[model samples]
Target: MNGHALELGGIEKRFGKQTILKGIDIEARPGEFIALVGPSGCGKSTLLRIVAGLESPDAGRIRSGDRELGELPAAKRDVAMVFQSYALYPHLTAAQNIAVPLVMRRLSGWQRLPLIGRWLTPRATRDEIHARVRQVAEQLEIAHLLDRKPAKMSGGQRQRVALARAMVRDPRVFLMDEPLSNLDANLRVHTRSEIVALQRRTGVTTLYVTHDQAEALSMADRVAVMIQGCLLQLDTPQRIYQDPRHLEVARFIGTPRINQLDARVDDEGVAWVDGTALARCAEPPRDRKVVLAIRPPALHLVAEHHPRGLTAWVKRCEYLGTECLLHLELESDATPLIASLTPELGTAYRPDQRVWVAAEPSQTLIFARSGERLTAAEPRLERSANQPEKLDV
Candidate 1:
């Protein structure tokens, strides 16, 4: 089946006094996988429902290819939705469940009549549907479970059945809303790869909605982050993590959360944190306060006597096998800072141990007071003649 590009223009939705989606716009290229992710009540699922024609938007238009989807009923939209619940029929076997859509579409009402419908239905039609069902089941590796009912299947097995049902339709677009949320942690990870492979093999344009950021980052070609009824950022996972357009995006995309420290830009356009020079800004200095955001991995711990580093007291250390996270409080301002350390280096420090921390100047991000990102052209290092020499480690 050939995929078609899908577009949403200025979509808006509201219920009573509460607004859910606020003039959101997005597009998915043909055969591309886009993930919509956000916290609870952020309208990620609502947006997916709107695209599937399951919910009406207060404003805006949905278009697939050159066809306008306005006023199109859910059945006529030609989009297949795999709901979060799997929504499989408990009484029907997997094969029969996957054949439901075909039975409704290919058989006439009179041919669908209980026992007599089997006699009335054409032999060729029944054979065709059975073949199609088996083909999809095989693709999902659920051919052996086709005769089993929903109650006899595991969560992952049932999920595969639902996907087979949707795939059998050969729709222009696929909408999946948290299809992996019901599975266990290991199963969820396994199923994520399966779903991505299935989508690619079928060349289907898909939109996946989930509250799990890791799933979105790992599975999608592009990710859209929604918060408070707004589409905060939409970009590749790498760009979204490395260079977030807004402070909210930066804080939401990373683990251990991005560190926010109060800082000042001096007359020489130098950004200082706890009296330690961090980076030189390209923007003209106004002696105004700004918020500096640094990821935990970008900050490194150093000896307490390092002159260019900020002296801090280690508050705690969390060892996670692969790495350690050190929580420290700056002595100059008492602000909290977190540094991701190697397992070896982290084991040497204990709580209340005095140390110094410095950030990688190139990796630091500066945000205005209003939460907008401040672009830096060049960042120069600051040094003092009388202070102890700086240490690279």
Candidate 2:
């Protein structure tokens, strides 16, 4: 089934005197998967709760398609949430758990009582509910576990049961809050693909919340980065990584973290680091200090005396099967630097080995001290190879 467009406008939430989410706005296109990701206590979960109606926004509006959902209770909103804890009833079998939503929505109170309720419920209604539960269980590949209680099922099985329960209702919007956080690493990876596939097959509008960057980057059509109760950036994964709008967004999105180095812009807008010219700012801020952010992959190791490289000493090496990380310290100011390399290249370096680190000019980002991203002219070396060259503005 096609899903409804979900919109959250100027969402704000607070816990007593502390604000948890500041004026957050997101418009998720119908059938799109959006991931809300950030470090712990960044209000990712709180925003999801607001959309699910578990929590009320201190100020904001939530809508599905053309309908205003702010006044609707959780159950009547036609939205389904699979929580971090799975929230399955311990005493209920998988089938029963998956059938709960349908039963509550379709059966009268008198027809919900144990033995007497079954007699009061029509055979057709009972058959419909049972059929729907089995259909959802099969879709999630958990039909075999339908007879077992939650305690007897593995974490993955229970997670599927939770998913089936949510999907059985055919919700217009689906919310998942770290649904695979409890699984083992391998299973978490495997289940991530499963969830993405399921969402695609059902064409549901999904909002997934997690602190895991990998999950957010790989599973979402677009990712929303939240920080300190504020929405920092919301864009496609590629843009979020390569074209971040803020220093905080750049610092939070990458693995091993993006390298931030001290820099200064002169009267002519040339940015320099340790006396070496790096880039030219578009709007020259005379005598202003700034930060240069470069992803690890944009750095390379060179001969110690290479003119274009920054002198550094290798501190250690981490060999991650397919890639390696060289932890280093700048010889000029003892600043920390990291370089991602191929396994072979990483193994060639040793602790205390002196090397030079060079960055790709096109990949460097300039940011003001206040964490605002800055524009810069394309950088190129203009002087002799042995002398520092001023970046042309």
Candidate 3:
């Protein structure tokens, strides 16, 4: 690893009366890739700017290793930032752009003049900077385009130039703000893997900000889900998606989005949705309103009138090659839900078809009305000596 651990504590920011960031805290271990993800205006970008020294926090401490970064100017922060715009100088060639940081940091005032600069600068310093530029450009596969200016390059090429520029500095931290958002869909996917590989090879601590959950989940070692100025959960990508600690995190993370149904947990700790029993709470709370979050893939269609399923009417059926998506509405409450099924399993289902929707007990997530996830367990099915099976709903 070639970087230092970056830490933020009690980070707060505001503009006039509107608070942009709440008491935010995050720590990125050396060489770790952390993605900051949220909807627009969620303070993700503000936090990144704070760390880069472009925007100062109203109250907080920013540190890398044992050094405090709060008071340092942006130029002195020893961090490289790749902006969404690619921010390449239109007038400069790719090689010059990649060497800008070294030129500024290594050459003196008189040594940087265009015409006389070459003569004033020592050959060794110039050669060293040139060699570094070539090395990084080659590493990024942009060596062939070194003499081309930004205006003549494609979006992906310019993006590579920007990345090479950042990597050439060998900064203690890398701050990237939606750097791949401008690329085409296929290119975005390809570039994502490249960036991940590059980060691993260089071992630079990175904080990437993106609104695309797919990008965040696929590329980051850890994901920080921020919402309405608060960082709700920070954990491994799998844990963030599968074991979200908060309801908002659950709702914001999945594709086709997680289905949320209105329900209430009875005094028996069993949650009920429209008269059908759902999951049970690990520790029962008094009768209270709760929400059940189930992913599309967690839901399955059963035969109509099945005892263990909720009655639903399919509103629409989308056939997507290998899989199918059935959009359904509960018969009792008309709550909207989606279920994922294999093509063979869903081919017979049509719009307006009546079916039963059932979720795996272990896959159902229960959350309080206040947006906190409640510990979930399987609801017990009781059968006394002479009585038939009955659910503790």
Candidate 4:
């Protein structure tokens, strides 16, 4: 926890009888970017609001550095939020909107008057406010568009202005909820890179929420995957994709997603589908149903059919410019299998053509019927030497 700038411990949120978030925990270090990602109804946005103080949790604690911000208002928490909508004033120019935060903080309580505020402005305070606004606008690269209103600017420009407003306050942390959502695909990619660069430049801890796994995978220092109001797994993008804790995380984090296949385990811990045994298998209950997952990229089409793998028939071919995605249907179970390759059509097989799909034993992942992941481990015995516990027991 020493390195963490924002910590949400055992956070639970509910509305009457409905639970939106259930015992969620997240940690973001100083100058670190964290992405909260889940499906549309999985409460990712609600959790962000809790961190922003826009929504209060039913139970649990949220802390920043050494201070516990359990119930602090948004203004008092020294945290800034940029919403997806940007929420800018249509009448105020970008510079005016950016300057509003500085004005509120620097001006005297009575000097906030629109017309007479100029008269009461202390010269030093006015200069400080203007300097701060100009500095943030320049940092955000919106100095050229400062005189334009929200309607007159592009979507990306408006987002920059909103960020400038947030940054003008020099907040310790930033809370962004789908800030790139409103932009088009190309612009979204550009803005995502900009936001990541800005976070690094400002050195502000940020908590971002989005349903896009690609966005989370590409930009976040750590990605937290939530499902049904519970945090499923939190790890780096590579770990979340390669070493998922369970079957659901494996399916949700990838682009085309990993294939989850039904399998049967024999009495000797060997996995089988229609009497064909797979090698290097993890041990599960004898004669129990299990799940075998192989990512699309891990499987290959073989010329000779063997007893080790299942036989599949090509159902459809989809060309996605970079690769040809072949949808293969298993002959025995009729399960759909997907294989992607770099536009290499070896035989020009038509639909319903038989193809032998094979994957190495190390590439396959096995999960129990209960959705618990199985990892290969060697059996070792350990005695509690210090505790004096008997190994026989």
Model 2 deviation from native, Cα RMSD in Å = 2.7
* Whole-model lDDT per candidate: 0.87, 0.89, 0.89, 0.81
Model 2 scores worst on lDDT over the 10 consecutive residues at: 384-393
Q: Tell me how far the alpha carbon of residue 182 in candidate 3 is from the true structure, in angstroms, after superposition.
A: 0.8
Off by over 4 Å in 1: 284-287, 305-308, 381-393
The sequence of per-residue lDDT tens digits that candidate 2 reaches over residues 1-393 is 588999999999999999999999999999999999999999999999999999999999999999899999987899999989999999999999999999999999999999999899999999999998988888888999999999999998999999999899878899999999999999999999999999999999999999998899999999999999999999999999999999999999989899988886776676777657767678765448888899999998876655457888999999999999999998777889999999999999999988888887778889888888889876654433553443222
* Tens-digit per-residue lDDT, 1-393, candidate 1: 588998999999998889999999999899889999889899999999999898999999999888888689888888888989999988899999999988988899999899999999999999999999999999999999999999999899999999999999788889999999999999999999999999998988999999888899999999999998999889999988998988888888888888887777766666766557777667843546667888999998766666457888999999999999999997876788899999999888999999888877778888877777887657665564543333211
Q: By TM-score, highest first, what's the ranking?
A: 3, 2, 1, 4
Task: Give one digit per residue, the lDDT tens place, for model 3 in 1-393.
Answer: 677999999999999999999999999999999999999999999999999999999999999988999999998999999999999998999999999999988999999898999999989999999999999999989999999999999999999999999999789899999999999999999999999999999999999999999999999999999999999999999999999999999999988899998776666677777666777887655557788899999998776655448888989888999888889998876889999889888778888888898887788898888898898876683312443233232
Q: Residue pairs in steric clash, candidate 3? A: none
**Where in model 2 is the C-alpha error above 4 Å?**
304-307, 380-393
User: What stretches of model 4 exceed 4 Å from their correct place?
Assistant: 1-4, 279-287, 345-347, 377-393
Every model's TM-score: 0.93, 0.95, 0.95, 0.90
State the displacement of the C-alpha of residue 179, model 4, in Å, after optimal TM-score superposition: 0.8
TM-score of 2: 0.95
